[model samples]
Target: MTKKLTGVFLVLLGLFATGTAAVAAPPPSGSTDPVGNDVSWPQCGKTLPVSPAFAIVGVTGGLANNTNPCLAEQLAWAGKSSTGGTSQPRVAVYVNTANPGHSGSWWPSSNTYANVTVSNPYGTCGSGGGGAGPVDLPCSYIYGYAKAYDDATIRGVTNPGTYFWWLDVETGNSWQAGTQDATALNRATLEGMATYFKGITAGKKGPDGKPAGVGIYSTGSQWGTIAGTVPPGSPLAGLPSWLAGAKTLRGAKSNCSLPGLTSGSSVAVTQYVAAGLDYDYACR
Candidate 1:
């Protein structure tokens, strides 16, 4: 499905990581921030924006375990981006994320994937017959790792480790809701996915010399509701956030000043909707 964009603009002031004071909203006529578009399965047969400054292609069919039918074509579209003056890559990818527990069609029954043994924080993830619950932190983490592995290996992405990844954590997708345990499990799943990406990008680096691995995409409210508090030592902590919810370019720019999902992270990109399509603004 296409990405969902929702949220209001706040006029509050703030500072960037470099200590530069925040800029005013409704950027000047010749702003330097690159404007790009994001597309996914829902745009399969439709006309996409021509020569976007950058492009974010979705790898899933709106679910964690499903593949986007148009991934290849959309990726090609992304590769053709002009990149303009943006710091973001011409082509980046995002994937849907969820934690449906054992209720999911595919659940991990072991703390391993591709022969790598995971040091699961919640203990060994195994069948309930062996004392481990059918659904636990280890299982959730393995499930996330498995999903990302499949997405990178079987979802048509080439040299998957070379590109940056964005985890799409939206309330529209399946998630364990309602309590602290639910939030922890959900966070475990995301951490598992991030681990896979981070491992593959071990020797790789982005334009800024940071790992070209995993980032997150979601609204603040949705992120808080789904992942709750990210522990200081968690893998998901300190990763950049791609915020959503603005309806205009000005709103997106303003949102760049909003707090990120984690304390050490900041919003590196902000999304807006116009003409029924999703547009992203890259923050410097």
Candidate 2:
């Protein structure tokens, strides 16, 4: 999507529910303190106004049909831009995962949907090896591993350490609707992704020495519509939140205190647009 169209869609999404700060919480434990931007093909080749502290690049399309063409360039630029900074500019990846059964997409005959999500991002980032073999599990579990595998391969990360790994959940993307089961499925999908990232294994570990800490990049309303409330004591309940929906830097800052979607997770980041540039506000 073009930046203009994306901006307009975000505007229509209402820039998060407006209100006074409902929660005062410190940044999540083990999270790096830095501002950043998340971009896909739209921002490619455009000069950013300031060097971001980090960047999260999208790896695949909503339906896992295509890989972002500029992921390598974006990653390379992120690496170069962080030179001489207080810390190396962190680079993370996000993937668009949806239900193939209800989202109007046909499951590939040869490759399971989860395998496709993993391979598409991994292969696109110059890691051409195929994904781990398909798991005869729920689609969500498969997708989680698919995303984790792709992220590990792209960064050449070899340890199961903590790093930012966001799942892009938005209404603009394809999703299943119409019943409580849909909500259950959606939650399962997210948990599946998180499970893969946090699980320990000799080969699954990334170079960062820990698994990627999973976060949700969506607003309360969108998440409710897509997956319902994250149940208490669920695996996803304690994950950090990356709040979306802000039109300006001030708006993003104000949103820093909104109630977190995850009960105990800190609201770690807020996304906003300023002067046609997408920016992030890391909650301190």
Candidate 3:
């Protein structure tokens, strides 16, 4: 379907987005500390060729840094996406209530021709609500969120082939900082969101009739300290597993300052420098 036609469908179906941070270049490489920083770029996702200790690629996104124009091409080459008619790239936008997107912003997404995942409506489970909802109940508002996504799909998105709708499991708290009382998240809170997310994308159908499991986001530190430690059969177990970390991405030095998060494994897609960055999900 044409882009215009797709937009029309989304409006009729009421499925769309509406609404931001980050790294200091030339400071020093591989320093998570806000004070210390990185000054080099790897043009790769692993780490420096000679010094493998420093990460080569890192993921960053938010209103602050998403606008780096060269990021996409860097990723395409980094992943060697040019092989097999694969110029398209899969992108994940990171957000919270703070940067919820404008009424009609299009995120730079993957090639409509390919089969891949693009999840939006991103952030922490019990967060971004302005503290109106409960702190964190197992399957708290997450079930409702699943129902909403499923419910929208049933009505039919403009181009189901072009886009797949999914919500963020955690906001700023997707990582841990070893400090007390940051971003309002805990095991139960995470569990509640994860359970609901699981129902929507991976397991049995939700009450709203959406499929099971879609996609998820969390930093590498969050993976090891938070999600990794979760017991088996929990909501987070089924996540697509994008372990956000610190490293060079497409020849840029990117960084994120989300609380409770630290670096670890590499992410499937990197979202460094998120201000004004264009991204979208291709519904072929």
Per-model TM-score on C-alpha atoms: 0.85, 0.68, 0.33
Residue lDDT tens for model 1, 1-284: 25542111110111111111111223223445568777776666666666667778888777787776777777776665445567677778999999987567777778877787876766778885653346778888888888888888988988888888999999877789776599899999999899888888778864434446789998899999999999989999999999998877899999999998986999998998766668889986
Highest lDDT among the candidates is held by which one?
1
Tens digits of per-residue lDDT for model 3, 55-105:
211122222122222234333332332111111122112211111111212
- True-structure lDDT of candidate 2: 0.56
lDDT of the structure predicted as candidate 3: 0.28
True-vs-predicted CA distance for residue 173, candidate 1, Å: 1.0
Clashes of each: 2, 12, 53
When summed lDDT is taken over every stretch of 10 residues in candidate 3, the lowest stretch is 275-284
- Every candidate's lDDT: 0.77, 0.56, 0.28
Q: Mind sharing the TM-score for model 3? A: 0.33
Q: Which whole-number lDDT from 0 to 100 does residue 259 have in model 1?
A: 93
- Model 2 segments beyond 4 Å from truth? 1-34, 62-65, 83-89, 102-137, 147-163, 200-211
- Tens digit per residue, CA lDDT, model 2, 135-159: 1225444444555556545534333
Ranking by lDDT: 1, 2, 3
